[model samples]
Target: MKALLKRGFNLLDSLFSRAFTPAWNPLYQLGALSFFYFWIVAVTGVYLFIFFETSISGAYSSIEQITHGQWYIGGVMRSFHRYASAAMGICVTLHVLREFAMDRYSGPRWFSWVSGIPLLWLLFASAIGGYWLVWDQQAQYIAILTAEWFDALPIMVDPMASLFLNESTLSDRFFSLLVFLHIGIPLALLLGMFIHIKRVTAPRSNPARGLAAGTLLAMLAVSLWRPALSQAPANLDMAVTEVGLDWVFLNPYPLINSWGPGNTWVLLVGLSTVLCLLPWMPSRRPKRTPVAVVDPDNCNGCGWCLADCPYEAVSMKEHDFKKGHKQSVVDPDLCVSCGICAGACPSSSPFRHVDELTTGISIPELHIKELLARTEASLAKLSTDQPRIMLYGCDHGSVVPDIQSSTVAAISMPCAALVPPAFVDYVLRQDLAEGVLISGCCEGDCFHRLGNTWVDQRFSMERMPVLRTRVPRERVRLRWLGAQGTRALQREVVEFQRELAEAPALIDLEDVSSG
Candidate 1:
């Protein structure tokens, strides 16, 4: 059944994901957009119904008047209302099915799984309520059928039949109650939707506007043509007659009319159970995690890789360089391993490994390419006699428009901690670049939470003893730059640039020859 569901929705899933660039699961956004468009329908429904008449005789006339006399705007409003509602129902159904297919409703999310059953029920009820407003022939049949089912509940006497149907109990108050219910039922729908995803944080919409807007317009066009209007004021006297039907709201409404409400109720309830429980069922296989690995030798230790890790798993440790800086490390336990790190690798040290681990590994080839790129760019802008700003930025940091500049050539890295001692010695030898400023994410903000922490760890007292051979430790410094750290980045860059100008050059010739 799970496989079948996946097969059925495979096309929709692809379209929705491609519809808009997705950050994670496509269904995640699909469910979000479902919520968004539902609100759009409800809001439009309220506006359209604000002037709607409740009396059976007046209801038909008022809707006709809305369509005919006020055809221009009312036409559009009615179209919007129908389209939005249908789209709402469609997206919501898709959402429930998608969740089930993806198997996200199990474990901690079981409650949300079960709560979704109410949406179908509420939507169906709302559709019935929609028919009731048109006061058409179908609306009359719907009312009669539903009222009969209500009578079966054994709650109260059949007042509508005993009074209105028999020309005895008719009153303005009865119409008012139906009107109130139509207005109130949507409140239940709103509550149901809210309850459905209560556990999800942010509960964002995935619609990219085009698909969402197109769906609304399309539904509206269909509704206006068939516009859910009722049969002529339901004659209590008439027994049975040919009548128009709208299956969109409750495609099975006519069946309920023929087969009796009791059986229909059972069938609907059974289907609802199946729909709601789907997300509840556990998946046969565990979901795969997708993050790559970084090679220290090929990795320039730019820390770009650290900023992109959304799950906070990658960190920098001492890399290939002698006794000076650290390399980026991956905590297998925390890595969701989204290959955003691999995308940012300067030396391309990190990548999806085709071997045993499947994590990307940096080797000599990758490092040489990046090394040449960095070397060429630096030499091109080498400040001759004057002190030049030595800007070291993480890969993720460089993408930030503020950080990318001529003065700052990003040291694209798997993690900031990977900056080796030997690299520092080589940079100081260049004479043009004054002071080194390393920028990456703040301590806890590192997508790989401890990656930045590792940067701090390697730069701390533990690694200082080894730094004596590489370069004057004072020439190189580190600072954390969070994704949101625009101001801090600016401040650090300026401060580092000033420090480089004022500071003496590391005139050592030791590391230059070796390089």
Candidate 2:
């Protein structure tokens, strides 16, 4: 099931990449886009609230005035509020599905995945409350159905449905309660949103400027074309047999009608429980996955590991061995075992003369020494003298083994970021391979969030342990082709090999001295 979903997402990603480009792709920025839509909803909702009436009798009339009398500004704001809320729901749903499809909602990521579940419930509650405030026939239907749903709960002492039994029963106080809830629930949702990204190192709370502007313009165009207008005023005497429904929030009403309120609640609760437990379900991660371990001897309390850790697993603490200085401490429970810290550590440099190649921080199972040995062994197997290429790929991205050949050697790491910049320089300076091609998860789609981004920054000399300026830039290539990029990886490696063959040979200082 997961494999199928992953393939579907890849197809959509490819199609959307052509239209919006990878940087502005809506699918890649779903979480950020959801946040952007939320802001739009909040701003437009505030405008609508300023002119709103908190009385059952006046609510319908005020909405009518806003819809027709002030059609230019107030009307547009109402439509923006409605559509942006729907857009937020869509983006949030897609973000959850995409994360699940990519198998990112497990292990150390479980906290983020679990925290997001409550936000869904809060969002629906807020939207439903907003609809009730309109005081139209649809809102009347929603109010009665929701009251009945609440009445089904065992904790309800007095039935909520009794309040909406007759025209005389409703009061301004009841309407005011709806208004308060509409405002209060969304504020709670906002807090949940913050908690959802608490563990992420650098959360993307906003989408790209171009994407944001485009989304807002599209919403504006929609508001201008089809303005949101309320139905006839709610009538207690008349039965609300038929009314329009916003499927994003009111889709559950149909289930309530088909299945009793008890059954509906059972279904919703069951679904939420399943979603919360998904991270603990049988997953691809090994039972005893190795976490990063800090080497106090090599660690100079640099704090690079702490900065590079995506899960906030690495922290700076007073060194037990070296007084005054600090050392990185890994919280075993929080570590995702990505090994990005290994790449960021300056001590990971291959140039360091040591019997055992160790870094400030590294995964116990796949340490720096193991990676260097793998790279050397892979490169040695390449018999061809025609511009040999060493391809480094991550476990989650392109299948590096598929493209391995006589001329090309491939080594897979937990993440592409696990390959230090010094390793790239080492490969070239030692003549292990003529060219090095680093490929991993697609741009903005790294399994370990910032793996590819950090790799790019390190290669560009914008981050620590920079790739040497002396190494020819042409010999090093970075390709982010995602999981199904085996063929693309082959093409890139071939092109890189051709480029290396056409370029001038690297000078050998040892040969010059001998000559």
Candidate 3:
């Protein structure tokens, strides 16, 4: 089932990737787009609130007035609010499913997946309450079904159905409570969203400016084309024969109507339980790799590695060794072992003697010293006359094409961010390779969360252990691509080789002869 889900997701992703530039791909920016829609809902909702009346007698009338009298502003705002809410629901659902399809919910990632479950419920509850404020036939239908469901549960002593037993049963106070929930639940949802992304370092909460503007413009066109209107004033005594529904948020209403409230509750509870528990389900796999560790003696207490850590796994504490200099410590539970911290450490340079080459923070399996040895061996096999190009790639990213050419060699790291900047310097200065090509996960879609970002910063000299100015910047090239972008990556590398051949040689042949 998981394999099928992954295949389905990949098909959609491929279609989107081909149709739109990778930077603007909707599949890659689901979470960001969802947040963008939420902002639209929040802004327009505040505008509608000024005209909305909370009294039970006036609620339906005020909505009708806004839908007609203030059609230009209030009416458009109403449609924007409704449509954005629907968009948010669709985007969030897809985001959850995509995370599941990719198997990103297990082990160290369980916190985000679990926190997102409550967020889903909060969004549903908030949307349901928003419908109640419209006071339409659809709203009446929802309230009736919801009251019936509440009554089905044994927690409440008095049946909630009694509130809808007669038209008079719903007082102004009842309308006020509904207003409070409509406004309050969304406020709570904002907090839930913060919690949802708490584990992520530097979360991109909004889509790029161009994509955001396009989305809002599209929503505006929709609003003007078919403005949202309230249905005939909700008459509790009359049956609802015809009602419009925003399928995104109201999809379950049909099931509730057919299955009855008890069965609907059972279905909802069962599905939510299954979703929440998915991360812990047993899988036939080997034991997990050990998390990153901090070498206190090697650490200079610079604290750069701690800041670079994506999962907040590293922290600094004072040590007596260097007259109260801080030492780094790693929290095994929080570290995802991406090795960005290792790359960030000033001590990660491979220029030291072989036995002494180590970093302040290192992943047990793929430390810098091990990477240095592998790189030396790979470079040794390449012919000296060839314009040898070394490609450093992320394991989870685009496959480094298995080139039949004699000039190029590829090495895969746990993530591109794991490649210490000094390795690039060593390869270039030591004449091991004429040029280095760095590739990783696509921009905004890194598998290890911050691998691409950190690596970019390092190369640009904006982070610790930065690629030095002495290395000719023209000789190094970076490309970000998705797993399916193998052909694209190969084309870029071929271009890089062509450019490297055209440029004058920077390596000193006399130094190579003497060594």
lDDT of 3 by residue, 1-515 (tens): 87888778767777876677666778888988888888899999888888888887688888888889988988899999999999999999899988887767876678889898988889999999999887778888888878887887879789887877667788778888998998899999999888888887778787877778888899899999999888777777786788888788878888878888789889988999988888877772224778888887788899988888877888888864777699998888777777888888888888876476887889987987888888888878887556789898887778884642567888887788888888898898888888998888776677877888888888899877789988888889888876766778889888888888887787544355558
Report the CA-based lDDT of candidate 3 relative to the real structure.
0.83
The 10 consecutive residues of candidate 1 with the worst lDDT sum are 350-359
lDDT, residue 326, candidate 3: 91
RMSD of 2: 2.1
- Per-residue lDDT, model 2, residue 303, is 84
Q: Which sections of candidate 1 miss by over 4 Å?
A: 15-28, 156-169, 216-231, 273-515
lDDT of 1 by residue, 186-210 (tens): 7888788787766443345445466
Predicted structure 1, TM vs. truth: 0.53
Sort by TM-score, top down from the best: 2, 3, 1
Q: 105-196 in candidate 2: lDDT tens per residue?
A: 88889999999999999999999999999999999999999999999999999999888887888999988899899989999999999999
Top candidate (TM-score): 2
Give the TM-scores of the predictions, in the order they appear.
Answer: 0.53, 0.97, 0.93
lDDT of 1 at 82: 62
- Ranking of predictions according to lDDT: 2, 3, 1
- Output the better candidate (1/3) by lDDT: 3
lDDT, candidates in the order shown? 0.57, 0.90, 0.83
